[model samples]
Target chain A: MPPAHPPVDTADVFALLERGRALSTPVLRAAVGRLAPPMDTVAAYHFGWIDAEGRPADGDGGKAVRPALSLLSAEAAGSAPETGVPGAVAVELVHNFSLLHDDLMDGDEQRRHRDTVWKVHGPAQAILVGDALFALANEVLLEIGTVEAGRAARRLTTASRKLIDGQAQDISFEHRERVTVEECLEMEGNKTGALLACAVSIGAVLGGADDRTADILESYGHHLGLAFQAVDDLLGIWGDPEATGKQTWSDLRQRKKSLPVVAALAAGGPASEQLAELLAADAKSNDFDSFSEEEFATRAALIDEAGGREWTSQEARRQHTVAIEALSRVDMPEHVRAQLTALADFVVVRKR
Target chain B: MPPAHPPVDTADVFALLERGRALSTPVLRAAVGRLAPPMDTVAAYHFGWIDAEGRPADGDGGKAVRPALSLLSAEAAGSAPETGVPGAVAVELVHNFSLLHDDLMDGDEQRRHRDTVWKVHGPAQAILVGDALFALANEVLLEIGTVEAGRAARRLTTASRKLIDGQAQDISFEHRERVTVEECLEMEGNKTGALLACAVSIGAVLGGADDRTADILESYGHHLGLAFQAVDDLLGIWGDPEATGKQTWSDLRQRKKSLPVVAALAAGGPASEQLAELLAADAKSNDFDSFSEEEFATRAALIDEAGGREWTSQEARRQHTVAIEALSRVDMPEHVRAQLTALADFVVVRKR
Candidate 1:
């Protein structure tokens, strides 16, 4: 057995993410560099390695949480972190692929405090570049030329399918008259949980870990992803716009059937009825284009008063605890477990 | 050696395509069936298996050329056609994936004599279902659980990347003032040639054909695809709309920088100059929306007068010859060679 280091603090989670970036960035860049012209530039811009003009820029590439999970999972399987770099890069590519397409589908103009790919380039390139990245992810894994790599690729593709399914459901829900809390949870689980579950276990699979151990890690990640999404949902509604870089009561404005709204609607109280009526009216209002921030705030207040906020917060905490508890089923160094625990804590309780 | 059959005619080529469909459709349907909810229905609609209302309808699905090529390629490599089924299904999925996305990207309203996926479904489901099909393509290949499958998956992904790259160039060309014939040919090669080449050779690869044999088949496919696209470009401008299932002078109407247009522009004749001026005027024309059928016909006449139509026809013949010559480099049954040659003839000369 490997020697255990001291318990890791929350700061180590950032270090793990940084290390993931450091390790996976070079390979990721190399793989992306293989793309044909204009696509190479567009992908580079999307990754924040270059400005829209193709000039170098220091931009906020997302925190490499999935990659970090991959590397740490590999180490947790008693393998070198390098064994996981391919898995890390593959998952990261898949993540960005979803982001590029998602931003376009949702018609979001900004990501990471920068203009989204579709906004900067166009929707066509966004679709094409996203496709290229997904292809690259599969190429990267299969190029490893091992049976284990094939297995990992299958997991990645399965997660990708689930992610797409979730997006379809999410889009469908926008036109839906009502969505159950259970349906929302299932969608979120597929959208976010499946990918994270793959990220956390794929490296170990690549490292030749048995199915049982990988399953445990996958369970940990699935719950953590749900928790992470719950926190994001909270931020979408109640968190400060300054902290979240989103508009106040963003989910309320969009009428997203997110966890909080679905749960609140399912709660069946007078406040829930009020919240539902307000949302229905907002959705059908002739003055929808003229709906004021104050109106949106009123809707947010109704959702909050319906206990959506508290229920979501408690759900996040519950998922977080379950995620932490799952670590006990796997054999890993104490430091890795502590680090994974700390990351879950950060995800569940993050302000933004 | 297998028994050599009678020399096959054009009728046999359709039979080949039908046989491919017969073998691959079940597997393809099964893979698509695995998709969730609306995506399943959406994909079925796109595949012409079902109408927009989710009722079964015999809509015009594609001719299954890629799958046909795959099965023929495996047979040409001295393997059973069954050996190529996975490759066939994988390429068909990739082809449909590109179609689903490209229809949205190009904003085309109709395909295969019916509404495109994005026209019937929303753009969001189009994107999601396209992504899911692509993921499924990779999954299908990798699940074969062999080194050959892994190798085939790499080839598939590489071609997929090139396809995306080609699409990017195609979109970029729309905004540019000029696109050289060479540049246009390169884009078409990536957009149309890469995936076709993958389809034709991937089955051979999966059949464990040696690199040299696969390379020869790939060469044949590459040339055949170029020939096929040249014919398509010709049809885009000059063919019957009823036969081609497109608008009259479709390429000129969209200002698509297809082969004929680029070649005509580069010919530098008086007609070329006139054609160039008219196109520039059209691009700058605020009345582009009001451009009549007569104006479009005028552009088509100028392109024809400039020898664009003849050049494209000659290019198609040249490519067809090159493709048939490529078949002589590798030894297969005489009937197989004849069948392959017949398919090339059909593609180079098809109205659509």
Candidate 2:
């Protein structure tokens, strides 16, 4: 209903993220460089550090959201962000590993306005490089050689396993006729929430936070991750191609069973029936190209009429509230808490 | 070249392998069971514990040679085989992770007398399950939670990296027209030797062996792995389908540039030229099935005529000798030494 806390300064959070990226990118680069050639080259390209031809190119790797959260969680635990660099690098690697493999699995050829690893290097190399990065993540944690290394590795591994589980469920969902909202949420929680939770918990652990604080940070991350995915699904259906850096109506054209679509399907009304009929007709035609702009517009309108859009927006706001509440459970410096709140607000509200 | 050690009792070595398998398979199964279902189902089917329909089947998972080596190394270092069970389980998981992913990448439909994970579960599931298992391997090592856990994980990660590197090189070699014997050996060393060496060294490290003893054991495993691959290449060319569970001349039919084929091509003689011509002709035809049985026989004869057969056999024997000598460098109980020697002997001499 109303805001429980004052609005956070989004610019400050972005600045912190930039600061986090600046601190972690070199460490991430050095860790990735340890891989043998071709793998290292592919990784560099994936990170937007180099062109496919190996020349330097300016590219945005990602928003650095996970690492920023890691750094902020560390600061909230009363440590400098530098103490969380290992955790930050690790979460980023795991994130990229999932992205590289997910692109191959989903057959997405474009990532961040460039060719995906599989598109450029072939699927075999893409698969191997993803694996190398996954291994590199663990090796980096272990190489830290502190008592915290073992615990950090364990948390990362658990999160990674959940991420794989969520991905598997996501793939399975594409083939299913209908998926419940509850199931969709579970899958999203595992797929997106686990890593985000791990990012926060790892930072807290590394920053010498007690178990209670780490658990609270993880809760904050879990809700924030759900909010992030909810907004992402919304963008997939409605955001401008120029802003999202993807083809217009790409997910609908591919008949992706994203959360919004699933929620609408589960809504069970005349609008839901019409939306189902449209999707079924598209499936029968088996020609994605034949679906014109009018058809896509109609489909988007039907989704909204079925209350999917409203449901997702409300869910994102609800999760954002829960995320902020979790942050309040831990007593931290006022500034650090403000930063975490800003990140949560950003997760729910980002347009791209 | 003469025997520096007496011949090992093959029966005793097989018995040891059986014991190691019995101890480690349950641990492996429990570890694998921790994965979410469908992934676990695919894994169980891949392990040959069940048929495609999930019914129990009498399927041999593998020879469990690596686990046996781990156990034997532990014993040689004055610990019980159970002390090496974690290492055994970790090695087996890494080995199977490779098998699952390699099958998908190489388009192999069959393995261990059944459809591969990718063939049965699809590439997406196969990829995710392989990732899960790889993470599981590291998780298992970390859960051991002793001071040794970090070292064990570091070694496993290093070996897994080399293993991935080797697989990448092997894939690259498939595209190249020619590969040197040295390069082939280097690839094989990374592909096959790294895991085997890790198997021995992990056991030694867990068993409290000093650096010298672990190094010697690792040396033993390196040569033993080379010998194992050499014999395997030989089998690919000449082994019977009934015993090897593969088509006759399968590697040649697929135009695989395995070690023997590469060595034959490098010989640069009349036979080598003829073999190259035959392969080039096959490539031009683009119909592997069009090759008559007589043509296949002729190709096999050319490999022999080019000294590929003799060279592979000689290399196997030489490596077998070297493997035993490395074992000899480590002074252990006489019986344990005999078991390691027997295992090495068995590796180079197995028919299938």
Candidate 3:
């Protein structure tokens, strides 16, 4: 059987990223100066322009994946990409704001292989800094400068709440002994799917797409988010640490109640019972390194027996199929739709 | 001179307070269920109706001052008092969100003589609860169900950023040796004045008042905030803790660079050396209690000699004049205008 993938031109994605930054950097630059000067350092860090010190560091570090999706969806829905640049940037700013706060909440000290904002700046400064970004996102929406712009702000605001709601649910599951796959999906819908859906909807709204086209694009984004997260869960355990840049079995160590763990737990049997005991023991232990490699192999075998990996991979493909169906539902320009569909497949099937 | 005090119609103000609560409480109740169920106790405590254990506590705390002002402003602008209830509640929710995060940032463990949300729930939970409130505020604005109703959300988002910016400046000021009154005012304008201005503007916007009327109400609110802070500065040193419920001379012990302190520092006299030395003393030591008292007396004398107190007082009166002038600029019913003018006077000259 052949791998089912769409035609993605990496060149198009790279070009959109460059052009999107050129259009949006000015807004961020102008707003950063107006921000409380004390937070300028952290804000700069968030943009990946500077390190904790006042000196400049890297140029730009984020994937810009969310904003690109927004801009591309707008273009595919028949609007110029430039028209939705502000919304694209606004969506990304909101995304980064949540990332900064999430890092603090989750107690992760490193992000992008450097000290996270809170670790360098302290929780007080980091919280306020994240708040400033949120405000800036709202301000950017106002810069949309039209009636439809107000409508767009309203939609983004709703998405913001859903994102937080998802985060809250994810945190709640940490202590729970039982969690269903349906409940897990709902949580991800808020945490991962809502913003992706918003990205496409905002882009289409700002792009002047009709309501039907925008709805179709929204559905596409929603399924794409689910597919992305499913693949992400698969990679959490199976992918190489060197390739993924994540600590080996870090999710298991954290007892994160991730999708795969929940699925494995739901498929109860002797293997599941053993996995549960290991988790309980791991939760009580301070030394994670002591957990033997053989133990990990056993756990991996158990996960396979429960069809955890296969289930998630299959679910990822299913979501992508739905995304393609959503794409077909809209009257998108053929080339743009093809590119977007290809991007969707790449997200689900990529190894890392 | 006979003090030109605004008439205090306590009954009217209290009624508006009840109306504001009636509108806002339900929104919170509805949203609370969606947060982490385990963390809902923390959220409830922050609202002041329940303890950290989720049991009923004391009566509603915090005077609901801003919300009352909002509803009253709408009434004073010739709309029915109930007309502004939705917006009044929205502003209050935003205010509470800031207060929660501010308490965390300030490291204040006590609020209204009870443990802060962070103290009982931990920082991570507190952060999410505050975020939930922020999201809920935006949701409430949308629930108001008018295109113009969203104007309040926009103003709130703007003010929320300004408040954070002002706070950023405040945090930075602690590290600096000298800060000018202009800089202080600019910071206060964002931190303190912005929200009050929004609170007042929201009222007029909800009342269906024109832009000019909203601007006038905003001016009234701005002046009221300035005057209120000025009086609060005075009370920080001289007011009885029994009446005010704040620690006596707490601001002095903290060596805060408030308006009066900045005014005295800028005077440039022989006493300036002693003032600087006292401020230079460690803020976290028990010696702060003794050193602060003597220095406070000396600084108060210097402030009087340098005309600092007089200048601040005169500024307050001037702003009050401007607020009244704004009221006259707008076309409203005579009784309503008088009521708002009275409210303006009450803000600057309140005794406790």
Candidate 4:
């Protein structure tokens, strides 16, 4: 049978999610409102709820998934839903902050089928918007107060530092001609896994969970992030752009050092050599029109022949299995456990 | 006789300054220590305390001025010195965070006679270092755990938002061909004034100051910032590069829409028209080294004729007067008032 939409039931998650949204929206709005008019416009553009004129627009944003994960962990750890809500808002703000800045650094023009903040507002404005989001994220963390402050603040800071480390490594890899599989995994672990681990750990901490519970929750989140990133990598190469709304093999065009590419490089054979040639060519090609479709196909075949796809998929499944095992170690309600399992499965298996 | 250094007589402010530096150094080191081994190496270089290999180097960093201001305000507000130290450290972190990122955006190559962070560590690593600084700033704020989570967090968030708003305006002004005197003031008010204002306000808030005292301190800092920025603008055009270590009239070469430029632009006439031509020529001048000193002086003369220098100095004096008036409004020790006044004098009169 096909997986249910949203994977988990989301009843509990959404309840906390809505509360966070309600709490944060006004706070965000008030802060932005007080800013100079131009900065206020940039902030609105980042939220995707307003046009440059500050009027309401199509208003679709990414799924507040990370925040929900954080809130759910906090709830499952036995904290009141309200108790963990500030962190919910904070993690979401930080995630969006990263997205805004990352899009600029990567020169990504489109997100959610619309112009990125930088695309519409320009790069400088986008950078400031990201900065504002980052500042607000910290402010929200501070709001979580003293009892939860120690752990949550520490986790958030570490996560933020790791996120930048990951991005730095990712960008550095592009300039280099070679990379190892271990380097790629470590990069991904810092970039994607740091925040996920923080989300769950913060939730557990705020929920009054014991240290052991927090550790187990953190493990679950770490593996979940790895699996999620793997699925994202797969989609970058193989998923339908129309469904994912991402550029077609955008990573390939950019010669991104993703898992599959890194894996093929590590195999060290003729196929790997061919992959390298394609990468070198791609680096020089201003437009895809310069490369023949057959050349693209040949490169794809080389990656497959080197067992890059299979290796990546197997690693992803291994992470998912480990995540499930970690979740099992936590003593939560049966329904919550099932929900988390579903969420983990969905992360590893999703096409988009 | 030359004025006595206020640090000699201002025992409380001096002690707080020492304590602030002590608290900040450890926190900053601890946070940077957690960076990935490679990233840590780069961070060390960026902090001016180490070589590329993370070996200790001379002349490590600037005076912790922002933290000192914060700590002084906290003490003046009657908060226990220990309780307020964290807030002071947080502001310093935020200041350094801005400095690191600003160097990247401004394409600055040198700081304090050494290579700028980005010049040494590369842009990607430098960006991460800045992000780390920002994260640590938040961590410091979060360390002030108390039952008043909501209010405390709100204040921190508000201050951070102001900081970003100021930065946005600063970046935005760089690209503008024209800006008003009011707009320039407003921009600096956010960019420079806001953080200084927040430094005092955060200290006051943490030190258990009455809202009235916070308001007074905030006003004092705000006006003081205007004086400082105006003086900086004056120096940018007229000061000795040997003393400032900045290119003489470099702001003119860059066609910066600073306070003097804005004032000159506002005082439109034949002089202003000549100033505009100078700006146009600057825009086309590809090589700073190629321009003769005679031509640079001639162009600067046009700006001076347009009343740029005089108007800016007059405005600086006006702002300083307001700052002194605000200082009078604050009910503090006579010695503390004298110390703050001395600092204010230092800001307005500094050549570098």
RMSD of 1: 3.9
Tens-place lDDT digits, model 4, residues A82-145? 5666666667778877887788778787776677887888766666677777876766666555
Q: Candidate 3, which segments miss by more than 4 Å at Cα? A: A1-3, A6-23, A210-212, A240-245, A286-306, B1-41, B76-78, B143-145, B242-245, B268-272, B283-315
Question: In candidate 4, which residue pairs clash?
Answer: none
What is candidate 1's lDDT per residue for A184-243, written digit by digit as tens?
A: 989999999999999999989999998899899999999999988888888888878767
Candidate 1, residue B300: lDDT: 88
Q: Candidate 2's residue-wise lDDT over B208-294, tens digit each? A: 777788778888888888988888888888987667766788778767788889888888899999999888777777677787888
Please state the CAPRI-style docking class of candidate 3: medium
- DockQ of every model listed? 0.76, 0.72, 0.55, 0.43
lDDT of 3 by residue, B172-205 (tens): 8767778998987787777778888888888777
True lDDT of residue A188, candidate 3: 85
Provide the DockQ value for model 2: 0.72
lDDT of 1 by residue, B107-210 (tens): 88878888898988889989999998999998898878798888888888888988888898999899898999989889888989899999989989999988
Q: What is the model-wide C-alpha lDDT for candidate 4?
A: 0.72
Q: All candidates' TM-scores?
A: 0.95, 0.95, 0.90, 0.82
TM-score (chain A only) for the predictions, listed in order = 0.95, 0.96, 0.90, 0.87
lDDT of 4 by residue, B1-352 (tens): 1222332344544465566677666766776676665666776676677865667986546645567677667667766545556666667667777777777767777766577877877665565677777776766565555543233345656666776776777777777778889988987887778777767667767767767887788888888888888988888788887776677776765567888888887898998998887676666667855777787788778778999888888777788778878978877767667666766666666676
Q: Could you give me the TM-score of model 4 versus the true structure? A: 0.82
